[model samples]
Target chain A: MWYHIDPSSGTPIYRQLVEQVQQAVASGVLRAGDRLPSVRDLAVELAVNPNTVAKAYQELERAGVIETPRGKGSFIADRDHTVTEEERLRQFIEAADKLVADAYRLRIGSERAAALFAERLAEAERRRSGE
Target chain B: MSDVAIRLAGLTKRYGEKVALSAVEMVVPTGSFSALLGPNGAGKTTLIRCLTGMIRPDGGAGTVLGVPVGPGYPPTALKSRIGYVAQTQALPERMTAQELIGLCRGVQPRWNDAIVKRYLDLFALPMKQVVRQMSGGMKSQLALTLVMGGQPELLILDEPTMGLDPKNRHQYLQVLLADSIETGCTVLLSSHDLHQIERLADRATILVGGRVAVSGAIDDLKADEKRVRIAGAVEEAVVLGVEGVRRAVKEPGGWLLFVSGASEGLVERLRGLPGVTGVQVFSQSLEEIFLSYA
Candidate 1:
């Protein structure tokens, strides 16, 4: 699975991981039953502590976004078994609100913000389709 | 067994009236990975030397692994149980990496060749190359391998990653952290590299002018000290009114505030204030913190 992180963002590293994984699941880039890399491997790739990656994974598991099995690795949870659409939408909107507030504080206009987000979504979709 | 692997109580060291260290108290917990960080001449090296029995402290009494540490008490047993790698390269010029490893194994009572070979491979050190001909990074790796091969219960390293390239530094840090975890060895390392310390150290002690300016778990230290930048004139009262702020300073165009505890919600509150253009939560880098203390 592909992962992207923006170090410039003030969000903590673990939160970044959590957000990226959630986005991947929401966009269908990470399908259910796809085994994710182990916490150690992800930490090495990201040059972060394994404990931080573990914390992210634990939170994802708690939210039913991922599943862990003994002696096996974590995998994306079945969508039907995960949170309801209402709850997922609520989380997405909360994140969007934070991003919008930050953009506004930086003097980004509403039109520019909306256009930039749409461009990013299209780019992501293009990449997924190419894959 | 005491929880502390090393303890210093009011330890003082002076070099001909130039006070190197003054009445410093520190406790290194058993099996904990601790990093002592300071700039040059901050007495980090002096403190490490005293702990390793290389030099005597002018005052104070303490113990290493339950053995009394003072004039009459030799740290013989403690020395044997602790492996030390000095910051400077100290490998014999004529000896090859493998030969030095062999020599160290002969001198140490409890040597493990299997571990030595594993580390040799892990670090990708050329076993046949002469120590004198080895690159700076290779020599550092060999020195670390020699110490780690002894499998001491306590590992004391003085800037293990010094003089290494970025890749070598990362590799060395990984080995150090892995060794600490697998062996449960108590480690006391002195380094100026903040990013590496952030990654590897479980706890850190910041030494400024021979005294601990701050010391605690890495996360706790970061969480307790918040870096806040606000875009307008900030009153002392306004800053003090912030629940977690411990210190505040107004820069030319912004205010830098240090919060003593978690200030997760302070950003939102600050954003709603008039004339506030930004509210950022930041953790001071080790270099920044050191400079501020200086």
Candidate 2:
């Protein structure tokens, strides 16, 4: 998997990398047990400092989103067990805030926006289950 | 080992009546990748030269890797451990890359031919081609290879990526980054590419008018300096009234406020002001921060 980082952004590079991995996991783009690129490899790939990549990986490991056994590379942790209900809800709310604000700007009514979200959620569930 | 790799205090230098460096104070922590940034004639090269022991500062003091470096202080004890790559070097024009590598290895206490060969192969630099026949990019890579082969504990790069294209530039930085990671080597690189530096450096010291304008961890620097957009017809005086707001510029619908020392309360204060319909805070990029000082 490829991770993209915006060097010019005000967000710290490590935070950006951490957020990317979280987003990828939330979207099912990265499944549990999927191996993450080693810290050195990812840093070289992004042309960033290796310590920045290590910091991101360290944060992810602390959050239980990824795990690295000795002599083994990092892998996405089993999300269902690793993430608490409260943590999952917080992540959902964070994603929903953007959609909600965007809908309000576009003048879409709450009912229609909620219906659209439900449809998308059902579609995502269907796709995941089918796989 | 001391935590500091380089320290400068009141380091002053003069070049024929022109002041190149004036009482400059800067520090590079051990194992940190640092970028020394400034415009042309901003004393960046002068400072690098001072740190590398190429020249002595007329006044003040400098130390590299725990050894005092300045006038009257010989660099013999420190020179072997530090790698200095200038923007241009007078490589013997007639020598092939292989021969130059052999020559550099013979003088250095530590030389890793494998490291040189690895980069040579990675960059596809011709080992048999003499320096006179190599292109600018190839020669640049060769210079870097020679420096890295010595396994210096400190790498001082002065615009090391001046001539390479984007792909080559990335490759060159990778080698440096990897070496730093594996060996815990400290790097003090001076470059004009803030975009690349932003990604590669953990700390940055922006010099202006031979003075240290801003020097700190990049994250803290970005956090402290911010731009805020306040909606509606806000008066400049009203925005300036806020404690942290430094300058207020008129915008189409409202005003843009340049703020320094932006604490959490600063944003809240901006939102509470009258006539403020909305307030959005943005962290300034490294380039913007440098321009502010310039």
Candidate 3:
């Protein structure tokens, strides 16, 4: 199983599963064409309601992260050029909001937050290009 | 099949001058796994009993699987379609698992031997062991197996995993999850196991003082209800003025505002409040939310 859910977490379980699958896809742990477990199978394995698992799969499908061709099961989508610039910015802004919120909570000044964000972005870009 | 599995309106039960249930209203849709939450003496058991037809309600009416359930309404016809497991099961001590299964099969109108066999085998319950000698976990397994034999459309379970170890409890819940998925059965579970309920139940009803304090789809409840932390001293009146702010409590550094319907827009409004250095929003877990109502 590549996904685990924390029921006690503030995040809802389906959303948690959604994030886990998204993270796995981003990290290259679950590559395109990898077959994900069926909703029933995953629910049984996780001891969660099957509806919850189905909701996660539905969200993934809507996001174009996974494709479920009828009778063939669900597989990670091949997204070599599917991502739009608008979509990219939308996702980035959602993440940046959390980063900003955390920075405020930690009392980190705007300068420090900007510097840390730039440093991490440079490292991520370097790793992505195999520099 | 009707869309609703259970519907109770003005459900009231009283015991000798003491009210067990006070005009409780609840609705459980078909195929939904719902958890009934309440503190001790909060009428959880009385409500279950009323729905199961074991006890009569002084007021209100209910329907189970479209069958009317209330005073003067015998649940005889409905009983065959419902499986009930009380918190403290009263299985005959001398009867072995096989014997109980045989007895149930003889009496149940919709008994399915295969389901019983499958559940007992999956749980590895000793069929020959007498009820008195079996472990608490095994007894629970046996009780669940016998109940499943009827292929019930609605399963009413009361603290079904009370004394079992964590592993056994997980096994029991897994079987239920699979069963519900396979059959689309509606389940009304009454238990104090918030963690398990949080994972298993999609809808929840929190009862306080024999009345429903909160009830909704668990996902919606968790999404809409949140706790916001203010960095500095803030006026309670001002915090309460924010849209959807239900309650406010003072904390060490600031005020913890319990806000319902605190979606992104509402949260931004909270952040813009005066005398607030930082505003952190935390979604309340089921246990935390239940405590607020319990």
Using DockQ as the measure, the top candidate is: 3
Docking quality of model 2: it rates as: medium
Q: Candidate 2 — which pairs collide?
A: none
Q: Rate the local accuracy (lDDT) of all candidates.
A: 0.78, 0.87, 0.88
* Second chain TM-score for model 3: 0.94
What digit string (tens of lDDT, one per residue) describes model 3 on residues A1-131?
84677777888899999999998877667878999999989998899888899999999887778999998999999864456778867878998999999999999999999999899878766755555
TM-score of each: 0.79, 0.91, 0.90
Report, to 2 decimal places, the DockQ of model 3: 0.74
lDDT of 3 by residue, B27-103 (tens): 99999999999999888998998888888899887888998875566557777889999999889999999899889
Error of 3 at B283 (Å): 0.8
Model 1's lDDT to the true fold? 0.78
lDDT of 2 by residue, B165-240 (tens): 8888888898888888888889999999998999999899999988888898887889898888899877788889
Q: Show model 1 residue runs off by greater than 4 Å.
A: A1-13, A16-29, A37-48, A79-90, A100-131, B1-9, B23-29, B60-63, B66-68, B71-74, B231-250, B262-283
For residues B116-157, what per-residue lDDT tens digits would candidate 1 score against the true structure?
A: 888888878887889889888888888888888888888989
Top candidate, metric lDDT: 3
